[model samples]
Target: MHSLNVALGARSYPIIIGSRLLGDAQYLLPSIRGRQVCVVTNETVAPLYLARLLDGLPGFDKVDVVELPDGESYKTLNTVNRIFDVLLEKRHNRTTTLIALGGGVVGDMCGFAAACYQRGVDFIQVPTTLLALVDSSVGGKTGVNHPLGKNMIGAFYQPRLVLADTDTLATLPDREFSAGVAEVIKYGLICDAPFFHWLEANMDALLQRDAAILAYAVDRCCRDKAAVVASDERESGRRAILNFGHTFGHAIETVQGYGVWLHGEAVAAGMVLALELSLLCGSINNNLLERLRSLLRKARLPQRPPAEMTVVDFLQAMELDKKVVNGRLRLVVLKSLGEARVADDTPREKVIEALKNCGVR
Candidate 1:
């Protein structure tokens, strides 16, 4: 098992990554306190791994199962309210620990629900998808998407523990697996230049789901993200760099409808757009842009925005991004191959041109 810590003073927790860690009780039972524990997951993941978790968590005297509909569309205030309904129905108190199972959606919503329930409660993240295992599950970023923006209605609620089982990725659809790779590549693009080159060489190993490669990628991404989260837990400054492709990506999600494109897919295209803007701004050279695009293409991700979207649609949707500062959009741009910074002074016309260049109507 590869174990790492996300230090948040009193709220610090451990992240355990490996194969079949979910079925192990020692890793789970210690973090779970009190008698009642609630497992919140989506429909797609329930049949596959819920029972294994339930069986492993024999330490809890009272266990409740709350299964939600699968997909990004269900990540909403309405869905969180459903979690509240279940907690109230079971007479759960503040001591109840909510276990979030499945991918980023399940982890985010469940963590949000736990934070809201009885003011605050304990929760664990069992991230089943590659996206969750590396990025979303570890950073304490919990929330649901609003109609207006992505992750706009959310909280920075840390989990008691995060357990990522590499075995689960084998079951993921090809598109979903590729989507997760987009985030992994972000780790390299934003920081870690050598890792980017490594990814350039090893994209096939990841797509093949080589056990060792997956473990290494998840561990490396988690360590990098943990360092950033520890430095700026609230995204006050440097942490915003983590939203590398998110501004435009979130716009794609909002315009296309949640779950249609998948979060990672949109971010994949969003990263391409970020690189384009950077190229136009003279922040990066053409070779760097082509290298980034080449890696994304190798992963089977789209290099451009969907043809159905318009420039106006992107701008309007991006206005809802949480990175807005006093009405100015703060986007993370690459200063070099492995360095990124927040730049709110991005020219609107250049952004429009980049959007148009990327196939936005």
Candidate 2:
């Protein structure tokens, strides 16, 4: 087992990465301080792993289980309220600990529920998807999607612990697994040129879900995220780089009507667009862009948005993104294969060019 600390002092927590961690009580005992335990999951995830998770938490006065309708479209106040209603019905108090037992959507909604339940409560993330394990579950960014945008209504509620039991990934559908790979690629793209090269060499191992490669990737991503969260917990500066393709990614999700294009799929296409913008900016060469496309295509991720999504449709949705500050839309763009920065001064036409040229054709 490999564990990394998020380093926020009093708010610091450990992210445990390994195989079969969800069934181990040792990893969970330290994080659950309360007697009431609530496990929040979705329809698809509940049957396969929820029982095993419950078996690990041996001694709670009362335990609650909530199974939400699965999919990104269901990430909203209504679904969150279902978890809230369960907590309230079970008469759980502030000391109650909420355990998120599925993918990113489950983690985000459960964390938000914990954050708002009687003000605040403790929560743990047992991430079942690659995207959650590598990105969303590690950071304190928790929120549901709004029809107008992605992750719009949410809170910065950190989890007490994040258990990434890679064994659970065995059940993810092929497309879902590919989606997770998108976030893993983001880590390498934003920094770590060597890691990106490693990905190019080992894309086959990742696609087949090799245990050693999976653990290594998860551990590296956790450590990367932990360091970033430690430095900029509220995204005041450096943390924004982690969003890499998210500005465009979120717009893709909103325009595609959520779940139609998975989060990682949208991000994969978004990264293509982001790199195109960087190319137009004269910062990166065609070789780096081809390398990105090669790796993504090898992983079977979407490299472009739907052919019908127009440039104007994307521009309209991106205007409402959370990353926009004061009237400037700050996008995470590549300086090279291993470096990225936030740029708000991108010319509208160049931005349109990226939207126009790199999009579905």
Clash number by candidate, in order: 0, 0
Q: Name the lDDT of candidate 1.
A: 0.91
The TM-score obtained by model 2 is: 0.98
Per-candidate TM equals: 0.98, 0.98
- What digit string (tens of lDDT, one per residue) describes model 1 on residues 224-245? 9999999999988999999999
Q: Which pairs of residues collide in candidate 1?
A: none
Against the true structure, whose lDDT is highest? 1
lDDT of 2 by residue, 218-277 (tens): 888888888888999999998999989888899889998989999999999999999999
In lDDT terms, how accurate is model 2?
Answer: 0.90
Each prediction's Cα RMSD?
1.0, 1.0
- The C-alpha lDDT values of all candidates are 0.91, 0.90
